[model samples]
Target: MSERRYMISGGGTGGHIYPAIAIAEELKGRHPEAEFLFVGAKDKMEMTKVPEAGFEIEGLWISGIQRKLSLSNLMFPFKLMSSMLKARTLLKRFKPNVVVGTGGYASGPLLKMASILKIPTLIQEQNAYAGITNKWLAEEAQSICVAYEGMEQFFPKEKVVFTGNPIRKDLLEVRSKREAGLKHFQLDSNKKTVLIVGGSLGSQRINELIAGQLSWFEAENLQVLWQCGKLYYDRYAALETESVKVLKFISNMDLAYAVADVIISRAGAGAVSELSLVGKPVLFIPSPNVAEDHQTKNAKSIEDKEAAVMLREKDLDDKFEPVFKNLIQDIELQKKLSKNILTLAKPLATKAIADEVERLENAVR
Candidate 1:
C-alpha cells in the first residue's frame, strides 16, 4: 500500500554497474512509484553512468586494494572506514526497505552496513568467479543471485539462485536489427563483419592484436567494426580504412551486435551474458591481469559448454591466427556456436533478480 524504497550499489567497471542498473530498471518498471538510490565508488564511471540512466547515485570514498605495495593499499583501511560510516549514514537517512549489491568497492561497505542494521539485502554475482566484495557480504545477504552455476562454492548453497546476468533491454532485439545495423555502420552485406569489443575502457592487448591483424583481415576480405574504447581510440583511429570502422565507444550496441558475423571480445561476465543473448559466434580473449584470473574463468565457463571459444591472453600470440582461421573458415562451426550460446541466454534475468528483491521486500513487510 505504501511506496517502496530500494538502494542499489555496484561500480568500478561497466560490467558491475550495468547489471545493477538493469535490476533497478526492472524494479522501477514493476513499481512505478518506487524510489531508487545507487551508491558507487567516488570518481568511478557509475557516478556518470547511473545518472545518465535516470537514477540518482551517491559516491563512497572506497577503492579496491592493489595487489602490489602502494600508497593506495596503505590507505585502504582509512577508505574502508570512511565508506562504512558514510554507508551507515546513507542507510539511516534513506531507510530503504531492501538493499541490493552487484559487486564493487562501494557495495562492500554499503551492503555490509545494511546487513548490520538488519535490513534485507540481496547480492548479485555476475562472474563465475565471485568478487571479494560480494563474497564478504554474502554471509549477511538474504539472497544471492548469480549468473553462473557452482556459485555455492562462494556463497551459501541455500541462498544461491541462478538468474544469469542482467543485460541492456535494447540488446534483446539485436536479432531483428541486422539490416538496420548494416545500414547504420555502412557495411557491405556481402562481406563478413567482425565486431571487436574490449570492454568500456578498451583493452590495450586486444587493440594491439587487432592492429597487427589488420592486413590479414584485409587479405581475407573481412570487414571490421571495432569499439577501441575511449582510452585507445586515438592510437587506432589512423588505422581505420574502407573495410574497417573505428569507434571510441559504441552507444548502439544492438546494431553493433546485429552487424557482427563473428565477434572478438573480452570475457567479463556482463559481456558474456549479452553475447549469449545476441547469439553471435564469439571468440573470447580473457584478460590475465584481472583479480584471481577470473576473466579466464568466465570465458572458460562458456567454452566448457561449447557455447563459445576462448583464447587466453598468453596464448593469443601463438594460437590466435590458427584458431581464428579455423573459426572463420568453418560456416557450420559459426552456426553451431550461435545456436549453443543462445541456449545459455537468460532474457528474463532482470525480472528474475527483481523477483527475489520483491520477495525480500515482502518479507520485510
Candidate 2:
C-alpha cells in the first residue's frame, strides 16, 4: 500500500515558512512512512526554501491582496483563479490524508481547496494579531492551532488549540550544549557576547543603531555576534574588529544563542518564541513597516510579562544604545529577563502539534 501523505502550505516570509517547515519536519519524524508535499506562492521565498529543506513543492500564482488600491489588486482575480485550479489539480492527483496551513498568501487557496475537496484541514496561526488569510479559512479548518490565546475573535473556540509556535528543534534542546557551542563560535568564556539579529532581509533601523555603537561595545570589553542581513553587510563589514564578528547571516543560530549574554532582535513571532526557549534577556526592536503593527503586539505581549524589552524603530536611534548598554551591564536584570522569558517557553510545541496531526488523521481514517 502507498504511504499516507500530507500537503502543507505557507510562505512569503521566513516567519510563516519556517514554522510550516518545522511542523512538516516533526510530522515526517513521527511517521517516516508519511510522504509530504508543500504548496506555496510561485515566486515566494518558499519556492526555493521548501525545496532546499528537502521537500517537493508546487507554487500557486496567488499573492497577497494589497491594502491600498494598486495594480496587484486588479490581478487578484486571475491569481486566485489560477492558484485554485493549480491547487485542486495537485490535490486530485496526490489524494493527501490531511492539509496543514501556516498562514501566508498561498495557504488560503490551498487550504480552502482542501476543505472543498472533503479533506481534513488545519491552520497554524503564528502572530499575536491574526492575519486575514487565516481568519478567512478558519470556518472550514478542522482545527486552528494557535500560538496566542483569546484568538476566539477570529477562529472558533472549539477549533482553537493553544499549542504554541513550532520552532526549530535545535533551539529547544540547546541547554546542555552551551560550553561546546561557545567554543564552536570561538567566543571568549569570560567576556559577555551579545547576539544581534535583524531577520534575513535585515532591519535598517537596527543595523544603524548597532553600527553607530560599535566603538562603545569594544570599550566595554564586550564581544558581538551580529547577523546584519545580506542588504546591510557592506556598510557594517568595516566594523569587524577583534571584538566584533559580523556576518550576513548565521546558519548556526543554536550555537549563536548558546554564546550570547544578551540578544537584540526584531519582535517577530518566530524570534520571540526562539528567544523564550533560549532563555536570554532580549531587547526587541519592532519594525514599523510590518502588517497591522503586529511586531509591536508580539513584543508587547512579552514585555507585559516583563519577559523582554521593547524598543521601537523611531526611538531606536537615541534610545537603543543606552538600553542595550544598560541591559548588558545589569547582570541581575539579565537574569530576571532570562528567567521570566524561560517561563514562557514551550519546548514541546513541535510534538504537541504533531500529536494533533496524528489524532486528526486517525479520526478521518
Candidate 3:
C-alpha cells in the first residue's frame, strides 16, 4: 500500500476523539511513512484536540440536530450539504487508502461521502449502544469495529468486529504507579480514597451531589480526588482541603486511577473502558443528558457482569450513599468488582483496531 494515506473522523467529545487518535497513532507506528488527515466538526473540540495530537484535521460546517425544535435544526440541511461537498473535495485530494469514522457529527458526512465514492471505510462504535452516525454509516462501511458485543443489532453482522475501544497507552502502567499517584495527589496512603469524574465539561448534578456529601465522606474518614471539570471548577474550587483535592481536569489519568481505591464517575464509553483497565471498584453515575441515554446503557452492561455498580442520576439522592458505602466497606465485593472489571480490559485495543484497518487497506490493494 503506497505510503498508506489515511483519513479518520471522530470528535466533539473525548470518548470519540481519543479512540480516533489511538487508532491513528497505532497505524502511524506500523507505517511510519503513512499520511493522515482528521475530519471534525467546525468550532468543536476536535478542531483543537486533533491538532494537539499531531494530526492535521479539516473541519466540516456541521453539528448534530437538536432534538427539541430550535434555530440550529433549521440549518441542518444546509450544513449537511456543505459538509458533504467539503468531504468530497477532501477525499478526492487526499486519496486515502482507508477512511475511518469513530462516530461524531462530522464523521457522518465524511464516511457517507467516502462510501458513495467507493472508498473503503471503517466505523468504530465505542459505546454498547450505537450512535446515530454509526448506524447511518453501517450499511456501506466495509468494517464496523465495536467495543461491545451484540452490536449486530445496529450494524451488519458480517462486517462487525468486536475490537474494543482504544484508551491512552499510559493507562496500562497504573498498577505500578500507586505510590507515585498517592504522592502526586498529596493524599494519605492509609485512608480510603474515592475519585470522582464527571466527563470533560463536568456534570452539574454530580458536582452538586458530591458537594452535598463532602461532610458525609469526611465523617467516613475518606479522602477525595475530584475532577469536577472545567465548567464547574470555579464553583467548586473552594471545597478543596487537605482531605478533598478538587481539580478541573486530571491530566495524568494513569496516576488518578492508581491512587483511587474506588471511583465514582459518569459512564461514558471512554470512562468505562479506562475504568475497566484500572480494575478498581467503580460506582457509575451515568449522565442523563446524553443522546439515547447511552451512558446508562454502558453502565448497565458492566453492572450486569458484576464488574461495576451503577446509580441513576435521578436515584442519586436516595441510593448514592448506601450503594457507595457498601462498595467501599465490603472487601469481598471490592475484590470481585476489580477482578471482573479487569476481565473486560482491552489494553491492546489500539493495535487490534489498527490491524483491522490495515487488513482493509491490503484487501483493496
Candidate 4:
C-alpha cells in the first residue's frame, strides 16, 4: 500500500502552531508510515519551530492585512497571489490525502489553495473570537474544530466541531510531575510554588509585573518559577535570588504546571487551553496588543465562570500584587477556581481533530 501523506499549516504564535503539531502527532500515530509536512508563514515562529518539532516545513510569502493603511497592506494582494500559487505547487507535488489548518494567516492561503484543488481540508480554531484569516476561510474548510462554545457567530453552524484545544500530553498527569518538578527546580517541596508563564514569545506586561514584584515571593514564603521571557531577560538577568528562579524560557511547562499552587499567565488561546488542563488557580493578564482584543475575551470566558481571575495590563502595575497575595491566602477560592477550570479540559483534542480529518478524507476517497 502507498504511504499516507498529509500537510498541516498553522503558525505566528504557539496558539496556532501547537494545535497543528498535536494533530500531526495524532495522524502520525494512527498511520505509522504517514508523511507529514508543515506549511507556515515566512519569518513567523513556525518557520523555526516546526523543524524543532521534527518536521519538514515550507514558508509562504503571505502576510495579514493591516487594520490601518500601511505600506505592508499595499503588498498583501501581491503576497496573497504569490502564496496561492506556491501553495498550489506544494499541494500538487505532495499529493496529500488531507490538508489541515490550525488558524493562522499562513493557514488562509494554504487551506484556500487546498480547497480550490478539491483536497480534503480541516481547521482547528483555538480562540472564542476567530481571526479574520480563519473566518474568511471557513467556507473553504471541510471541518472546523473549535474550543469554546458559540463559535457559530464566526463560522457555519453545521461545520463547527467543539473539540477543545489540544494540550501537551505530558501535562495530563499533574500528580506525577509535582514531586519531580520541585526536585528539578531545587525548591522547597513543602512551600507553595507559584508559576508565571507568559506564552512562547512572552508577554511584555506580564514580564514587567513579575520582575517588579519579586519581593512578594519571599514575603509569602512562596517558591517562584518565573519565565522572564527572552526579550526582557537582559534587563532582569542580574537578579539571582534563592527563592526565585528566573528563566528565559520554560521547556518543561508540564512539570511547572504539575507543582504550581498558583499560575500567573497571559490569556493567549493556547495558554488558556493548556492551563485549563492543569486546573490550577490562575490569574490572567491579557495582552491588549492582540487583534480583536481576543486575549481579553479569552480571559473573560474563564473569569465569568469563576474558573480564573483577570487583570487588564493597565491595572497590573497598581493591583497585581495585592490581588495575587489575597488569592494565595484564600484556599476556598483556589479550590473553586481549580475545580471549575478542570471541567474545561479536553485532553483528547488531538484525537478528536484527527478523527475529523479522517472522516473528511474518507468522504472524498
| The best candidate in terms of lDDT | 1
Following a full C-alpha superposition, what root-mean-square deviation does model 2 have from the true structure?
1.7
In candidate 3, the residue pairs with backbone N, CA or C atoms under 3 Å apart (3 or more residues apart, or in different chains) clash, namely none
Candidate 3, after superposition: displacement of residue 161 in Å? 0.8
Model 2 Cα lDDT, one tens digit per residue, 124-204:
988899888888899998988888878898788999999999999878777678798677777788888889998766888
- Model 1 Cα lDDT, one tens digit per residue, 118-205: 9999999999889888888888899999988788988999999999999889998887899999999999999999999999889999
- Local distance difference test scores for all models: 0.93, 0.87, 0.92, 0.87
Candidate 4 ranges beyond 4 A from true positions: 67-69
TM-score: which is higher, 2 or 3?
Answer: 3
User: What's the number of clashes in each of the models?
Assistant: 0, 0, 0, 0
Quick one: ranking by TM-score, best first?
A: 1, 3, 4, 2
Task: Give each prediction's root-mean-square deviation over alpha carbons.
Answer: 1.3, 1.7, 1.4, 1.6
Winner on lDDT between 1 and 4 is: 1
In model 2, the Cα lDDT at residue 106 comes to 90
Candidate 1 error regions (>4 Å): none
TM-score of each: 0.97, 0.95, 0.97, 0.96
lDDT per residue as tens, model 4, 1-365:
34588999989878889888878887888888889889999999899878988899999998888789999999999999999999999999999989998877788888898999999888788898998888888997878999999999999999999999977677778877888888888778888988988888777777777777777777789888888777778877787577888888887888888889999999998999998888899999898988899999999999999999999988877888789988899999999999999898888987888899889878877
